[model samples]
Target chain A: MMFYINQTSCISPQEFILFDDNHILRKATGGKLFALEPNYKNIPSAQLRRMGKAVRFGVGAALPLLQQGNDVNGIIIGTANGGMEDCMKFLKQIIEFDEDSLTPGNFVQGVPNAVASQLGLLSHNLGYNITNVHRGLAFENSIIDALMLLNEHPLNTYLLGAVDEISDFNYKIELLNGNYKQQSNEGTDFYESGSQGSLAGEGASMFFVSNKKDAAIAKLEFVETIHSSDEEEILNWVEGRLGSHLIEMDKIDLLLTGENGDNRVLKYYTAIESIFNNKISIARYKHLCGEYATASAYAVWLICELFKNSKVPLHIMKVGTPPQKIEKVLLYTNYLGEQHSLMLFSKVK
Target chain B: MTAIVVTGLGIISSIGNSAEENRESLIKSRAGISKNNNFYSRYSTLLPFGEIKKSTAQLMEELNANEKGVTRTSLLALHSIQEAIEDSKLTLNQISSSDTALIGASTVGGMCLTDQLFIDATTASKGSEYLSSYDCASVMLYLQNRYKMKGIVNTINTACSSSSNAIMCGARLIKSGLVKRAIVGGSDSLSKFSINGFNALHILSSDICRPFDANRSGLNLGEGAAFLILEKEEDCKGKKVYAKLSGYANTNDSFHPSSLSEDGQGPFLAMTQAIESASLDASSISFINAHGTATENNDEVESVAMRRIFEKVPAFASTKSYTGHTLGAAGAIESIFSVFNIINQEVYSSLNYTSPIEKTGLVPNLNYRKTSVQHVMSNSFGFGGNCSSLIFSKH
Candidate 1:
């Protein structure tokens, strides 16, 4: 089933760019790559003050897309750690106050569905609002739901996206688990540092999707996710998915990967890389966005940019000759070598 | 188009450990709200909750789930999912197949260990085993890894209506030919995190809840899990088919984050759309499982919505009066109860109801009795004005 990406917006670590403008990729110098949030002058101050970073980026990125019209049938959001700042603050307040006389402000905003709910409230698009919190597959699952809903109702437009914020408390907790590298290094340098952990990252990306091909920049062709550590199993699944679409591996113009400089999981990317065999341009994005559960959302935004520009950005290209004309792009991302996701996108012709 | 049918049901709530036990409790008009004995909380003594009687360790041992980093939420989910899959007679091969989907929902996934997470973040230099399980997706991820589920595995967290949306999503998936079968439900364990959160909101009732009562106080937060196996009607040949998932619709009030509109527009749209989707008239609905949290806002608004939808509202009751408000798990647990209403051709009474609200003069069924239940509508409205309605009809 094909779904059109009618409009796209993102707030990531990289500098915000327009569809026709030249892109500039930013690099994280430390273990954390925080979002370069735009000024919320467009949003009402009272509402903006209550939103956490995730909800801000989410509603900020989504509100503009809904401005075209308020006919959105649903608002779907995905996040692994939603509204973390408020969640932690509420948890801390419970302890400090000994669970007495605490306010509901933070608690209400801390729930994982806060983004979708907030968007629904702001846009007044009281449709099928939902949130997906599945680890690495969060954004992909949102896409799947949007696709199914559109397929069920072709005329319906949906606002789908993902958001995750990096908090001081969460960062420290994750550091204990070695989810981030110990050393401070440039994003690109860390990719080749042969390290054990990837840099932490946070961002929000939203897409307006519908079944209509007109006015669409790109068409999402396929999306699939799996939980496996075996490289061969993932390889076979990718091939099977492509074969179902009747597309040859050589036909893919760009192989976008979520290689976030984790040495242990580099082999999985390498295994997938061998299938292309230098036939197509391969690029990486986590260097710009860092590595988070919904980093794939940023990848989708990048794919939209590449399709809009019809060229691969120099900073993201890692291997293979740049394609003369970018047509079909394949995105393969893995979260710690366990959660594997494959998404295929093509220029809407 | 293929019709979706519920072939198997599994549930673990305060009233019982299995489906049979729950059925017996409902038949005997048993209410499960009580003081917490297994879960520890500051208000555990002051407030009543629909807490499962067993401890986490006992649940783990009973389910043989000794996996590291497993939380109580995951354990409850595993207990119910085991029963669901077994009741459906689905083999490991079928479960591991790519055609099967598991869509779980939870608002309190692994946040049940908020205390541990707090200690690890604030005091301990090193995180505990519960560190990785602190997110809302942990429960579904744990279940997926345990079952080695190869198909679409996703988790939805839309507050209290989470599992209703899960069930709706599963039905849509099966109807869309995306998957052959789906295991859909939600699980939430009572914890200090949620208790404090609810208390902070000033919605937690000290006494057992009284849904639709004239002078209802508030809701008692509960803990439980429920899963239902849904497949195409054609697929369940000789299985113990419970009911057909005739229709479902999800809508938002777009009104407030924590409160619905006074008119209950979201619930009205949800109920109307769900009935329309089933291609049935509002008059056909035999019983309704209302969202009624016994709050001043919810019960009144739900009654107004019911009045708007039906000329004379059918026999309806709030199972939350029996189970307390189970939050994320209430949708599916009540959905299973709705199945019992169909399979047994009966309607369970709403407990502790005295008088109707003056605004709507709506009185819920106060007694359990056998009836010709053909279609049942289950309502779940959650935070963010997320309202959903599901209809189950006799197969």
Candidate 2:
């Protein structure tokens, strides 16, 4: 099943606009890459004050698209850790005050579904609303659901997105867990650094998906998540998907890999690269967006840009030359060698 | 399109540990809400909770779940899912097949270790073993790894309606031909995090909860897990067919973050749309398992919505009075109770009910009796106005 990406928006550590030659590459500082949030002047001041980082970035990225006079039939969001700051605050208060005299503000905002719910309330979309909280496959699951729903409705458009924010407490814990790199590296050099850990990052990316192709920028060909650590099994699964879709290796113009500079897991990507046989131009994105569960959302956003601009950004291209006329792109990402996901996108003809 | 049918059912709640035991408890009019004995919280003594009579250590020992970073939430889920798979007679090959999907839901997955997490984050330079199991996805991840499930695995967290949406999503997956079978349900264990959170909200009842009663107080928190195996009707050759998933609909109220609208717009739309999707008239519904959290706002709003949807409201009762509002697991547990209503051809009484609310003057069924139940509707509403209604019918 294929659905069209009619409109899209993203808020990441890089600039919000499309990349240009003069665009400065933003690098991680102190092993953490935070989202470059837009000024949420469009949202009400009172409401803005009550929103958390994830909610703000999610809603801020989606509100402009929704304001363009499109009636969305559903709102689906994916997040790994939702409203961690608020949750941590509530937990601290409970421990401090002994669970007494505590308010309900943080408790309500800390739920995993808060971003989707806030989108629903703000957009007045009473239709199907849900949130997916799977680890690295969170955003991919959301897209799968949206496509299935589009298949069911046929005429309805859906607002689909993924958002995650880094909280100070969670960052500290993850750092201790050895999930992030101990030393900071330049964004462009992080992938080749062969470090033990990846930089911690956060972002939000939203899209308007529908079955109709009118005004579409790109078409989603396939999406799947594999739960295997065996390199041979993962390779076989990817081959099976390509064979099922009848997509030849030569038809794919670019291969986007989610290499987060974690040396231990770089072998998985090396195995995937063998399948393409070095024929396809390969690019990497975790350097710019950092490594989080749903960083695939940013990858999709970059694919949209590649198709819209008909050029691959030089900063992201790692191997081979940039495709002169981009048509099809395949994305493969594995998180900590446990969760593997593959997505294919094509330019609308 | 082939109909989706439930082939197996498993439940562990305050009432019982299995489906048969739960039914027996309900028939005997035994309410499970009482003072907490296993969970240690500041409100444990002052308030009543429908806590299962087993500690985390006991559950771990019984389930043989000695894996690192395993919390009570995952243990409860493992207990029920094991029963469900065994009851369905699914072979190991079928269990590991890519055609079977697992959709789990939870509001408090590993947050049950909030105290441990706080202590570790505050003092320990190196994170503890519990660090890997601290997010909402840990429960499902643990289950997926344990079962070796290779198909689509996803977790939904729409608060109270989490598992109902899980069931609904599983049904959709089957209907879309994405998978042939889906093991769907949810589990939530008692935690100081949730107890204190609900206390902060001022919705925890000190005494036993009395849903639909005029002077009903708030709800009592509970913990448990329930899972139902759903397969296409054509696929279940000789299995025990419990109920057919006929209809389901999810709608947001777009109102307040915590409260429903005065008119219950979300509930009304969800119920009506579910009925329409089932291609049945409103009068065809024989019983309704209401969301009825026994709160000042939920019971009244749900009542208003039921009245608006059904001309002569059918026999309806809130099972939360029995299970004490098991947040994420409430939908699946209540849904299994609804299936029992169809399978046994009987209705269970709503305990601790005296009078109906003055506004709607609605009265729930008060006695256990045999009846002809054809179709049953189950409602679950959660925070952010996430309301969902599911309809099940006799197979």
Candidate 3:
């Protein structure tokens, strides 16, 4: 079974336009990286202004695509940090206000499925709605749910995506644990020559999945995620999946690894580098978008563009191989060696 | 119709940490709900909970685990998963990595660490050493990394129905040929936020929940995780099958965030679809593990749904009476209960029930009765109008 991407929207540190934007690999920096394209005013109004960063990114990412697929059968949104930002904010407010009276906005938005609920209210698409909130597996589970729906009834469209945001506490905790370096400036290049760590970036990528196959840009062939045991196990598993699909080791054209310049995780993807024999082009997105739990979602949106436009961005592409046939591309990513995801896609007819 | 079979099962709740213990507890009508052990807050004194009597130290010793900061949620997940995987008798290391997938659910992954963070969030810039636990995804990913499975480690949190969705997704994986075997379950530990949040809603009972009763006031929150190892029909050809997962469906109310829609439309859609999906007549179901949160709004909506779907309402009871609302683990935990119905051929009572709610004229069984059980239907509805019902049939 296959599902079509009827419409897709994203909110990244770069421009807030959809993935079809002209500017490729727009650089992001500063204390916190937010989607350049988020137009909160365009999505909703002051009545629901209490939404946190996750909800805003979620709405901005989904609304436009949903408008195109208003008749979409269902909505499934994935959030790594659903209402954490709201929860944190609410907890702080309660502490500061001496618990006199708590506001409903924070508590309402703090619910894990707030984004999905708000989407239901906004679009009035009452067919089916589910919000999947598993850290790195957030989008994977959402994608799987959407796939199941497509299998049962071939729902014409599904709003599928992932969103995560970093709070002041996120950075403060990082700084305390040495995950964040001290004295880093606003313009610091996270993966530059002297850069030591990846900057924190947050956004949402919502896809309008359908089965009509009309004017479709890409079709989802198959996607899988695994929790890797170690560096050796991840590569072998990737090879194993490729073999099961009747594709050989040497045939893989592009291998997108979720390496965030971490010495440990980078090495896991590194061992497979020679196995690809440099014939398979290797790509890393943490340099472009920075690293978080669901950085792979951004990586996937990036690869979707690469499939459409054969010219890959030189900045993000690590190893080079031209998109000669662009027939089958294998995208692989690991979240700190715990949950690893692989999405195989081919240019559809 | 595609058939998804439940080849194996495992569970760990306050009442019973193992399948055998759980059955005995259910037969005797013993409850695991009690008071809190921590001296963390005054709320513990006010709230008697379905607290798992075991301590973290004891769980660590049982698993022989070296790593620390593993939340009670994770521990419950590991415990249930170990039994489930073992019950399936499928060698984990023997199967191809691509054919095995691990799907776990949790509402809050490591918020158990939040108590430790609470101290630091105010005084210092950061919390304790385990900032990673603060992210729900991180905890799940940690589980995936530990297991070394390559197929999928997807975490789902649709509020309370989170685990039920996880199990359904696992079955779909098998039906889709994504994997031949999938490990599915959900886990959640009681936390300050959930306890306080439910308290704020004024939908929490100070004592054990009396579900489906006329005077049913509110729900009791509990903690634990349960899981089942699902395999393709071919994978379990001659094995003794515990129960077959025949039909399952999930529907949303799209109503209020915390409350169900007035018409019980969510459960209405879910039950009908599941029954239809199972390709079985409504009369086939002999028992139902109702969500029956006992909140004024929940019990009415759900029972109205049960009455609407089944011409003769089956012997339905809310097991939440014994195992509070386990949150993300409710679906998996109840799935085990439903399977027990398939095995024991008996219906457990809805404890502390004096009269049925007049709104629907629906009355849950107030006492245990022995009978032949054929099909059991389990329903789990979460905060987001996410409603899911799964059907388990005698194999």
lDDT tens per residue, model 3, A107-193 = 667767778876766776555777777666678778777887888786457778788776665656655654443544334244443
Instruction: Report model 1's TM-score to 2 decimal places.
Output: 0.98
| Candidate 2 docking band | high
Off by over 4 Å in 3: A16-31, A93-105, A174-189, A192-196, A248-257, A280-283, A307-329, B92-97, B119-129, B138-146
Question: Which residue pairs does candidate 1 place in steric collision?
Answer: none
**Model 3's CAPRI class?**
acceptable
Error of 3 at B94 (Å): 4.8
DockQ of prediction 2? 0.80
Candidate with best DockQ = 1
How well does candidate 3 score on lDDT at residue B32?
80
* Residue-level error in angstroms, candidate 1, position A122: 1.0
lDDT of 3 by residue, B85-164 (tens): 78878775733376777777788677765556555555654456566666555545556656655566677777888888
In order, what DockQ does each candidate have?
Answer: 0.83, 0.80, 0.48
Ranking by TM-score: 2, 1, 3
Local distance difference test, candidate 3: 0.74
Better of 1 and 3 by TM-score: 1
What is each predicted model's overall lDDT from 0 to 1? 0.90, 0.89, 0.74
